[model samples]
Target chain A: MKFQQSQEMRNLIAAIFVGIFSYFIIKALTDFDIVPGVSYIYNLRGPLIAPNMITVILFDWRGYDTLGEAFILITAVLTTGILFGRGVLGGDVSEKDSTPIRPSTIVQKVFAAPLVFIIVAFGVVITLGGHITPGGGFQGGSVIATAFFLSVVVYGFKKNVFNLSHNSLETLEGVGALIYLCLGLVGLGLSGYYLYNVGADLYPYLGVGDTATRLFSYPDSTNAGIIPYLNIGIALKVLSGFCTIITVLWGAEKK
Target chain B: MNGSEVQFWSFVTAALLMIIGIYAIIFMDNIIKKIIGVMLIGDGVNLVLITEGFKPGGIVPIISEKLYNQSPGIFQEFADQASYSLPFALVLTNIVIGASTLAVLLGITIKLYQHYNSLSVHEIFKEEKI
Candidate 1:
C-alpha cells in the first residue's frame, strides 16, 4: 500500500537524479582534457634509475604516502582484532561445536599441492621483478595472500599446511614495517631526504650482469638504490596484513 | 569513434556505475548490500582516475633500451606520448586503502549481526529502541 508506493516514488526520483547527474558528468569529462601534454615520468625515471615508472613514483617520489597507507591497514587490522575479541589474537583455541570443513575428494587433495607451489612461485617472481615489469609489491602481495587463502579454504583452517601462527604473522608484519622505516632512515642519513634511494647505485650492474658481478660491484649514483628493498618490505607487510585479517575473521565463532 | 570519444564513453560508464552504487547505498535495506555498493563506488572512482590519465596515442610507461638507444631527442618524444603514471600510482594506493576499509566494515557488520541477529538496518534500529 503506502510503503510500496513510496518505494516506487523513491526509485523514480533516484532514476531522474542519476540521469541528470551522469549527463553533466560525462559532458564535463568529454570536454576537458585531463591528460597532460607531457608526462614528467621520463625525466624522473632516469634519475630514479627504476625501469618501472610506477614503482619509482610509488616507492621513491611518494614514499611517505605509502608509509601512511601501511599504517592505515595496520590500524584497520587492529580494530578488527579488538572487535572480534580474544579468540583471534590468541588463536582458535576454543572448542568448536561443529567440525571444520575439508576438501572431500582425493583428486582435489592431490592437485592442491602443485597449485599452491605454482601460485607462491609466481608471486615471488612478480614481487622481485616489480621494477622491470608491470607487477608491483601490492599485486604480488595480494597474489601471495590468495595462495594462503586457497590453502585455508581447501585444507581447512585447523589443518592448514602453511602452519602460520597468529603471533608469527604479527611478527612478520611488524618486521616488514620496521624494515621499511629503517630503509627510509638510511636514505635520510645519506642523502638528507626521507625514503631516498641511496642504494640505487648498485642497481645498474645488478641489472646487466650475473649475481657474481653484483657482489663484486660498487655503488653508483645512477642506480635505483633503496626502491627494491622498499618493494620487498611493502610486499611482506601487505601479504601478512591480509593473511592476518582473513585468519582472524575465519577463526571467529558466531555466537 | 575517435579516441577521445571512446574515452568519453568510458567516462560515462564509470559515472553510471558510481550513480548505481550510490543508489544502492541510499535505497538498499540490507547492510551487506550497502557494503557491496560501497565497493562498487570505489571501483567506479578508481576507473575514473585511471582513465583520466589516458593519452590519445600512448605506449606503456616503461622505458626499454630500444627507445633509449634511438636518440637523445627521442626521450622527449617518448615522454610526450606516454600516459600519465601518477594516476596509476594513486589508484594502487587507493585500492589497498579500500580493501582494508572494507575488511574493517565487514568485521563490524559481523559483530552487529551477532548482537542483533539480523542484517537489516531497520530491524536493528527497531530492536535497539525496544
Candidate 2:
C-alpha cells in the first residue's frame, strides 16, 4: 500500500512539474522581445492584413506550397479509404461499447442537445468567415467534427449517431474533395495559375481578379493572380477530409 | 515580455513539448500513449512554423480605416497588410491537417484495440507477425 501510494505521488509530482515548466516557459518567451534586428523581414506588405506572416507566405508568395498541402490531404484521405475499404459500417463483433457509466440525467441530456447545436452553428459561422478572419474551413470543420465526436462520447453510438449513417459521410467527403479540385481548376483557367483568387465579387462563380498586381509586389511573380481560390479550396478540402476521417472511424460495421 | 521574448519562450515551450512527445513514443509501450506523443510533436512543429514568420512587435497585415487613427501619416497601403500573412495562412491549414491526422491515427488505434483486445505495441506487432 505504501509503495503504491508513493508511486501515485510521484506521478502527480511529475504532472505538476511538467505543467509548471510549460507555464513559466511560455510566460518567459511572451515577455521577451528582441531589439530591431529582423524587422525588415517582418515588414513586407501583402494585399491584406493577415493574422500572421505565414499566411502571407503561403497564399501570396509560395502558393504552390498550399497546393501541395491540399494534395497531402487528398492523399491521406485516399490512403485511409483504400486501406480500410468501403462498407465498414458493419463488422462481425458481437459486443458493443456497453459499459454503463452513470446514465445521463434527462436534464443533462436536454441541456446538452441545445449546447451541441449552438456549438455546431458557431463552427459553421467561423468557417464561412474564414477569409475575413482568423478562422477558416479547417478550423471550422474540426470544430464541427469535435461536436460530433463529443456527441458520440456523451450519448454513445445507439442514441446520438444513429441518424448520420456511414454512407452520408462518404458522400459528403467525396463531394467536398471534388469541390476543392474544381476550385483549383477554375483558378487555373481564370489566371493561368492553379487555385487563383476569384474574389467575393465573383460570388457563386469563379472570376479572375480584374487588376492583377504581382503577389506582394515581389519580382518572383508566382500566384500573382490566384490566392482567394486557393484559400477556398483549402478550406473545403480540409473540412471534408476531417469529416471523412470521423465517418470512417465511427461508422464502421459491427455485428 | 516584449515581442521577441514572447517568440523565444513560445519556441522553447514548443521544442520541449516536442522532445517529450518523441520520448513518449520511444519509451511508452502503450499505443495510445504513442499516438498522444505524435500529436504533441505535431503541435510543436506547428508552433515552430508559425513562430518562424514572426517579426517581434510586428502587426498583422490587415488594412482597415482605423489604422489611420492608430498611426497617423503611416503609409495607408502598408498598414492594411503585412508580408507574413500568406505563410501564416498556409500554416493554419497545416495545423488543421496535422490535427486531422492525429484523429485518424487515434481511430486506427481504436480499430487495433478492437482486433487485439490490447494496447501494447509490442504485443500487437507480435500478433501481426504470427
Candidate 3:
C-alpha cells in the first residue's frame, strides 16, 4: 500500500515536471529564432576537398569527435558482450525453448538471393560514392548490416551465406579502426596538425593536369585527401560492429 | 502556414512525442516499454535538430554547376540559399550513438529477464534483494 502511494506521488511529480518542461520548450521553440544563422561555409568548402559536405565535416573538420563516437560504439558492444557473452558465467543462460520456424516456400524462393545481392551492391555504391553523393559510410554500413540481418533471418544463423565468424568480424572492426588511426597519424607526420588534409597529396594523379575541371570540379588544387579512406574505414568499422552486436545477441540463446 | 510556423508545428509534435515517451517511462511497468520510451525521446530530439536546419526557401546543400554558374563565387551566394548541413551531420552521429546504446540496453534487459523470468520492473525489484 505504501509503495503504491509513493509510486502515485512519483508519477504526479513526473507529470508536473514534464508539463513545465513542455511549456518552456514550446515557448522557446516558437518565440525565439534559435536556429543558428550560419551559412554553409563548411559545406561550400566541402566540394573543394571532398564532394560530400557531411563527410568533410565528419571525417575532416571533426575527425576527433568521430573517432570518439566509434570508440563509444566499440565500448558499448564490448560491454554487451561481457554482460551476456557465452561462457562468461559458465555458459549461455538463455536457451532456445522451441524449434525454429521456417518461412513460406514461395516467399523464400522469390526474394532471398536477389534481395541480398541488390542490397549489398547498393550499400557498396553508397559507401564508395560517399564523396560524390548524399550517402556516406554510416548509411552504407547500416544498409550492409541490414542485408546481413535479412540473410540471417531467412537462412538460419548457422546456414547463412555470408558465413563470417565472430572472430573475423572482430578482426575487421579492429583493422578498420587501426586504419583510421594510422591515417590520422599519417596526416600528423606529413603536416603538423592531426587528420590534416591540406597538401597531403592523397590523389596526386587525379588532381594534376587539369587541376580544376574535374567532373566534380574541386576547387583550386584541393584534393580529397584521406576523406575517402576515412569513409571506407568508418564503413568497415560500423558494418562489422553492428554485425557483431546482432550476431552475439542472436546467438546468445543456444539450443 | 508560414515557414516558421511549420517549424513551430514540427517542434510541437516532437515535444509531444517526447512527453509521451516520458509518460511511458514513468507510468509503464515493463522494462521494454521504458526502453521504447527512451527511443521515442531520442527520435524527438533528432526531429528537432533536423527541423532547426531547415531554411525558409532553401534547397539541399549540394554544390552543383547551377549554383556555380549563377555565382562563380559559390561560397558567398550559393551557401546563403542552401539549408544548413551541420545539424543533419550531428543528427546522423546522434542516431548511430543512440542505436548502439539501445542495443547495449536491450542486451542488459535480456539478461535481467533471464535472471528474473519476468519483464515487469516491480516484480524484479521485489524479487531481488538489490
In model 1, state the lDDT of residue B85. Answer: 81
Against the native chain B, each candidate's TM-score is 0.90, 0.78, 0.90
Task: Rank the candidate models, highest lDDT first.
Answer: 3, 1, 2
Give the range where candidate 2 chain B is weakest over 10 consecutive residues by summed lDDT: B78-87
Candidate DockQ values, in order, are 0.52, 0.23, 0.55
Root-mean-square deviation of every model: 5.1, 8.7, 4.6
Per-residue accuracy of model 1 over B8-38 as CA lDDT, tens digit each: 8888778777877887787788899888889
Off by over 4 Å in 2: A1-45, A48-64, A77-103, A150-163, A199-237, A251-255, B68-83, B127-130
Q: Write the per-residue lDDT of candidate 1 for residues A1-255, one digit (tens) a residue.
A: 012543677667777877787678767766766846324644334433666778777887788998988888888877777776644655634434233575458876777767988998899889877776788788888899998888888887767767888788888898888988998887676556677556554334323224423432224322566676777888899889999899878866677
The DockQ-based order of candidates, best leading, equals 3, 1, 2
Runs of candidate 1 exceeding 4 Å displacement: A1-24, A41-48, A86-99, A201-222, B71-74, B127-130
For model 3, residues B15-84, the per-residue Cα lDDT tens digits are 8878778878877889999999999989989988989888888777766665555654346665666778
Best prediction by DockQ: 3
DockQ class, candidate 1: medium
Please give the lDDT score for candidate 2: 0.57
